[model samples]
Target: MSQDQSDKGTSLSLEQILAQAEQDQSVETDYQSGFVAVIGRPNVGKSTIMNEMLGQKLSITSHKPQTTRHRIHGIHTTAEHQIVYVDTPGMHLGGKKSINDYMNRTANSAFADVDVILFVVEAGRWTKEDNAVAKKLQNTEQPILLIVNKVDKFANKEELFPFIEEIAKEVEFTALVPISAYKKINLPAVEQEILKFLPKQNAIFPEDYVTDRSTRFLAAEIIREKLMRTLGDEVPYGATVEIEQFMFDEDEGRWIIHALILVERPGQKQIVIGKGGQVIKKIGTQARKDLNNLLDARVHLELWVKVKENWSDDARALASLGYNDNYSS
Candidate 1:
């Protein structure tokens, strides 16, 4: 086995290691790699920008505010560089009992160890909330890039200049990039700015690898995304998906996945199930389709709804839900 594979603790089946070595040898001699954290308020298109940067849906995104709860890293490798982009939860003003407070802390924590911070903003308006967030970015030691997303809505460049100036006055940004994350305008410029900030380090992840998250975690996230999209308001925010069992039968070429949709209360459970299991059935069908596409095989997905009262507040439940004090800022 190659040294790299061994370091990853993978006892690759001889054939795999040789194939990987051949691919590794073909990589460019001089390569740069680093991490960039994307931070902004809810619904500013941070996830959308990360997805566009990687040229794939590495992060789950939706129209609802604060869709991303955790810090998800998407690695983009080129012949010259490997950029591990971290998509963080949105930063906003928080209340003592509010989950939004928790999310804001998560977003700010990404700035601690990253090389660059991409501060995304909505193109149309700059609210007082936007100014407050910009002020926080000014205090960060790392290089900050002001990215004005949703610029496609603007009719001309002149219309965007005022908002751009307002942000620039607040923070000493490394670069101010106006791009539409949805429409993918001026994305090449964003990529160029990312390269400039990246450290001169060897590639941390193998060229073929895209993310650090497991297939199961991503599957659960996709299900959560569907829940966030289809189920309106509080249902999506208050819910979490946990995979109880995931067994892949190599000989049979099938995957058996049993997951529990955990909610805070019985009333929320009823909403998820809907009238006669209609909503959950729809959730299952959509989730299965996504699973099949991601796994490249048939998936026998079994979903069960369980009410765990105050799962967010319970320490053990928070740990099980993938939230720990270590993740807190």
Candidate 2:
């Protein structure tokens, strides 16, 4: 017997060892999959990058900060690999309340058990706040990919290189990619670099699955996103969307969704409803369009704005708004 067979004793052969190794490798190759977390300060276009990467809007985008409060997973699959992207809340320095603390914790938690960390930075200007964030990311052991977003707005790319180089000096990154998520430039290059770090593994999600959030969850988020965009800063930090009812009729080919827009004060409620209820109507119309597209069915969306003072501080109100105190693991 050969030396390999001798090591395996009389029960095994060299061919079997080689075959098992090949099988393992095959499994690994098929399983080219891993989780990647996108982190940055608010309004850095993290959501834009994720949507562009997946070619869908799994996470809502807005100009306002703290749009994303939870960790949302967007899955992308190909014949060779599966990439699960985790979209997190924008990290900020400090806030007085527990909710702000929760948001910060949720963003930081995405770094754990992730294969790649994409640190998104605004390209137009680099602030001291951005530098502090870069330092925190540099402390992580996982591969970091520095993505400078909004590059299209830059008048001179040469002026931006110094900021990029400064960040590079702060941390060891696998790659530094400068691209505009809004303009969709150099996105393919970013995807390719992310793929290189994922391990081979079977698909963790169904092929058709795009997001881990439920339809109700998405509906609430879409409503809130429209409110954010339309109402702008008039909406307070404590405002949230609560789904009162979500029902579908297969025979009728229609979905009936009833959601309430919870605000911190009565004045804010009036702001959401607008003059002659026109503002709420617009928000409903826009949300319904998104819901129909997401659900692929006719949607009847009913929205109501109500005053729920201090919802952010009220534990019961927070839970009703899907901000479970136990969300932190």
Candidate 3:
């Protein structure tokens, strides 16, 4: 999806919604705020949904499954509510490796702590993975908003009625809506449902903040997203982008970010670097443009590809790659 996908939803600001709410002075509306977990199986457009909601790309996304490794928080604050959206790794049916266990742990941990969960799934496609997530939801009484994403991909609009009816029988959902996260369809409806469930309380984060992640983290994620889109399925498993150094120049008024792209082996590194370093160069250029827009300042991005043998399987290696347990907490 384009970086401007968020713009599609921002035609009406949250404040405008709050202004309408404030009109009724007799109602005495207490401020609402809470955490919401966006959970689903891999490649279900969870990140795409949240990024569009915030009108900024805080999370990295690609066609590849398991693209989101950390439980990232995108904060949307207003006089009415502050919704801290948690984008977790897609829960999968695997545990042979430490990374798989780490992803499952990161995703499942959010359910217990959040006020609402967006159980996302693709339109007209229900796999065993979706069934696994629904089966787990049966144990919890938390308010779940069943999000059937990618409705635009369907050949006919009528295809959604049966899809909605079939999936509704699988679980008890608080609300159900079919949306195209990529096309910015029905996002406001989802946002309204989310606000309806949030508890009445003061805001947890500052009003200006859109995400809990730093600019450096966003840089690395942008680079990884470009690599995923560029390399396609040829990209190796367990590849990650880590920012080595992030600093701003006081004299030049620009941000300089040094990133290390970690791959499983030398052969995979060769694929990422490409002949004459063309692939990595392309990734850096694309990432730099997003950084410029995200920070609203000049950016100089330095990228390096390195081999880390089986880093995903080793706990210490995962920590070194910035997958530490504290990152999400």
Alpha-carbon lDDT, every model: 0.78, 0.79, 0.81
Q: Tens-digit lDDT track for model 1 on 1-329?
A: 12132112123332363355446655555667778999888888999999999998868889998789887778898888888898988876653433555677778778876888898889878776677788887778888888988888978879877777777788888888889988889999998998887867677666776666666677788888888887989887679898888777677767888989999989999999999999998999998888887777788888899998777656566666766434211
What's the CA RMSD for each of the models?
5.8, 10.9, 6.6
Q: For candidate 3, what is the total of clashing residue pairs?
A: 0
Question: For model 1, what is the C-alpha lDDT against the true structure?
Answer: 0.78
Clashing pairs in 3: none
User: Per-residue error at 28 for model 3, in Å?
Assistant: 9.4
Q: Which candidate is the best by lDDT?
A: 3
Q: How many backbone clashes does candidate 2 have?
A: 5
User: What is the C-alpha lDDT profile of model 2 across 213-290, one tens digit per residue?
Assistant: 666777788888998888867584668888898777667768889999888888888888899999999999999999
Candidate 1 stretches greater than 4 Å from native: 1-29, 98-101, 325-329
Q: What's the CA error at residue 276 for candidate 3, in Å?
A: 1.1
Ten-residue stretch with the least lDDT total in model 1: 1-10
Candidate 3 lDDT (Cα, whole model)? 0.81
Candidate 1 matches the true fold with a TM-score of 0.87
